[model samples]
Target: MHPNKLRAFWAARQGLLECDTHLSPETVLEQTGWARSVGGVGPYLTLFTRAGLTRPAIDRAVAQLQIHELPSARGCTYVVPRSDFALALRCSQGFGDAAEVQTAKKHLGVTDAELDRLGRNVLDALAGGALDPAALKDRLGDLVRNLGPEGKKRGVTTTLPLVLGSLQTAGEIRRQPIGGRLDQQRYAYARWADSPLPEFTLDAAAADVELARHFFRWSGPASLAHFQAFSGLGVKASKAAVAPLGLLPVSADSPLLALPEDLDALRAFVPPETPVYRLVASVDALLLLRRDLALLLDPADVPRVQQIGGLQDLPSHAIVDRGRLVGLWEYDPEREDIAWTSFVRPDAALRAEVERTAAMIREHLGDARSFSLDSPESRKPRIAALRAG
Candidate 1:
């Protein structure tokens, strides 16, 4: 495949160019794959840009338990649809807790026995109803032990998070943004009345295979390296996980693999001739899932990529045309306008897209954060850099 054509193909597959009237947030997730939610607006923008889902609609879905953020593959939180919650939580099982547990044990003198006791306390506390972190901590009193200086140095701070994380991984409780919004990090804990882990029949290995299927279908023609990176399944497990999928290569010597059912469609797919502009979050699956931005760039843009930050990341939220990344964007809250710089010359279509997305952000989202710490003040440098371009 021609390089640009390949990029556009990825764009189409990501639901950027081929927008659809997906009836619900979960339906969009089912089609476009899970939206990465890093205490940011990526999930909302992803649903809006791809499925035309509004903020009110998405909030309603969350309020009604249609979709939610869950720790899944690689132990990263993704805004998952209701249908995949069990699969997501199942895949997350041992993966999410290993590192955190190890760090707590080594640095804060944490023990499995200590966590077991705290876990029970946490469950009992939430049995009555949900509680935000402060309230939960206050309710637990000294039961949620403070680790003092050593813990503070290592960023562990307290035993509360350790138990909370362990319990969440074990599916005893769920973390919800205080007001059920995806953008902020303040979370409340609630007992999952119908916890999926209890009913999830798939064991660890089977769950890994299921997640691998999702990875391929969402970002197919993706390399095995991509799957390994996303799953964090290490060498042998990652290979074993995808081995059952019967994935095929794009060419005789191609590194990329796709599901068997998708080969014909991949071959027949065509890049859009007219400019199809899309403004999306930095962590949108189109880039983050593959984590190989260099592959998405035109050869001419290589030097510019180096000048900015290189292939692994973008300096700001992406401005994509068809499937190819053409520019970078940031929302200027003061002006209530989108500030962007493009690899291609600024065109009417691109500006129009900026306006449309800006309008949506102003009226509905209020802001588009790259991650939890992102703010208007921090965005100035990137916006200035874009304006300078």
Candidate 2:
């Protein structure tokens, strides 16, 4: 874990995730910059956007990465860039608002009544600024009509979940623990949905296994348990999915196992002397291998971080150096900016490195500077919530 290796790992991980190319596992493996850390689709979007790729093209690229499919009565499928609900809503309305909600209704084929209900949901989301899955489920309870004849139909509400499932199958929307009630336990959000899918298919155990292989390739040298965690697959399915990947059995030593490429990149990026970065936990949801969060974060920090500024703070789309998160990044629409935050008692050498990383993030963003992250004035309501939390 020399500094050079750490640097290389971050470079490769960041590069591959930032790439807009439609990469199969083989192609991704061949890329020196590809890391085994891109299970979530959000960072993938940044990679593609930074590379000047469009959303549709990215979807095609993700589809090319698929190795399996699932079957479901709803014809539901799962993949990376899991759900585009937010993006779909954005595509329809450009941002959050009642008008956007209306557009989303049309996009989902829901009726005016449904749209109104949806509008209320969207408005509430904007006001709250983050959706706590369980809270939202409670909030929306008695409202969700399951698909069927009496209270259900093959209409928008019914199809909505399938659409979300398709994104999940595609690696567009990822499933993560929310520590909420069962119904709210699995809520959906999107950071990678810009990569729109033309279809979604279910992932049977076999398909799940194949997909797990893809997960490992992008984030491996990881354990079978890690693979299952990353892919949300059962042990049998996960093992089966990756069995065909031809993984090299290099050694039984090393606590931090990684794919050879990841290992090599890690060697290049993780400096043994100093690996300190203040990474946003939620961003880890889209970056760190789902199964290996403990490696990067203190177990105790997870919940507090997840509940606090976690959801409201737009995903911190920046890379961690050594292990310290040194950059601040944002994707306000098309522009992606990563500002180098002041370090805690940074030495000259570290400052120089931070500047270099910040420059790279800025270069990737180009002229898109519509968003700014200057601490906002303490508004009455937010101040109240801040104190409350």
Candidate 3:
């Protein structure tokens, strides 16, 4: 890496960590850059918040880091973790794409004309604090079914899944099982955060502060727009939230930003070209480093790995060698095994490093056995289908 590129990489990586998604440090790791970089959400969040990150910047930063497939409509009818519902409700107000509009209508079960009305209803529910999806289900059930044919087709049914996906994007909810046969669409909800509503105000004080600091440390040679994209706080708000966290003023006045202390520490490491190993998640912090993923992957191979269907199809697990993504890994949760399938051939050193990582994963999933991909069907991650919305 050139001296300048090294500075930029450091800033970009750390900046991603600082994004405010309100996820536990562990969850954030699973969602952001350098997945499993540390142990324990407590210390990670403490260090992150202490460093400087406002809630909104943190959220936007995290958002910018993910490569998502639009969620499936039927299984995604409800959002998990209430805060996501609030954020999605807010984020969706201005979006008017044809597909977006159509999806919204299908989920809500309403007609074209009823789109605005349904939107208002979703917003109303959000404002009123109907945080639970189950509760929302009961409250909106009548409205959803009452929409006319097109209303049913366009309004409630369509909008329901869209809302769910948006909420998931905002990191406020997740999809989980409700009940029924293993293959049925019987899905319900599970809350991940204490705050069910999106705190528009967190763009300033609160957890947002911690998030910003994380980003500054991880991703310095970065722009506010990049930060905003990563955190999901929107550009202007991301800038404002990040403003108070001062910068190190590195020599070139490059767009890069760094924490004063880290600047001193970085001085010790080989500037810009240090070899560091990283395991990043699909939604990891580095995703926000560049708007287009091709910065890290070949365009031809991207769709095959990042198809948005599941972890297996995408390079959800990747190895970052000296700040560049070099290979991919995937886990079979049921078998508790890690499979390393590298795109590039590995020499002895890289192979050894990969094996060591596999060992670490096995240790992390204690009591679980490691199995080859040829392991029985029971050893594979189970694929479950849910009933229609």
**Residue-level lDDT tens digits of model 1 in 261-374:** 777788887777899999999988899888888887888887898888878877689988877888999998888888888999888988898998999999998988889999
Best-fitting candidate, measured by lDDT?
1
Local accuracy of candidate 3 as per-residue lDDT tens digits, 1-389: 24434533453444322335454433433223332111112112222422322223333333432311112111222111222333333333333334564554455444655544544465566664434565666667755434346545444433455455445444455444332111123344333353334555442233444456655655544566566654556666676667778765555755655677756655554433433444444334454344434445544546644653432222234555554555655545454555555555566756665555445445432312222122225433421110010
Ranking by TM-score: 1, 3, 2
Model 1 steric clash pairs: none
TM-score of each: 0.97, 0.40, 0.46
Off by over 4 Å in 2: 1-7, 10-45, 48-206, 246-286, 291-315, 322-324, 327-389
Model 1, TM vs. native: 0.97
Best by TM-score: 1
Ordering by lDDT: 1, 3, 2
In terms of lDDT, which candidate is stronger, 1 or 3?
A: 1
Q: Provide the global lDDT of candidate 2 against the true structure.
A: 0.38
Model 1 lowest lDDT segment of ten: 91-100
As a TM-score, model 3 comes out at: 0.46
Who is ahead in lDDT, 1 or 2? 1
Each prediction's Cα lDDT score?
0.86, 0.38, 0.42
The residue-level lDDT of candidate 1 at 350 comes to 88
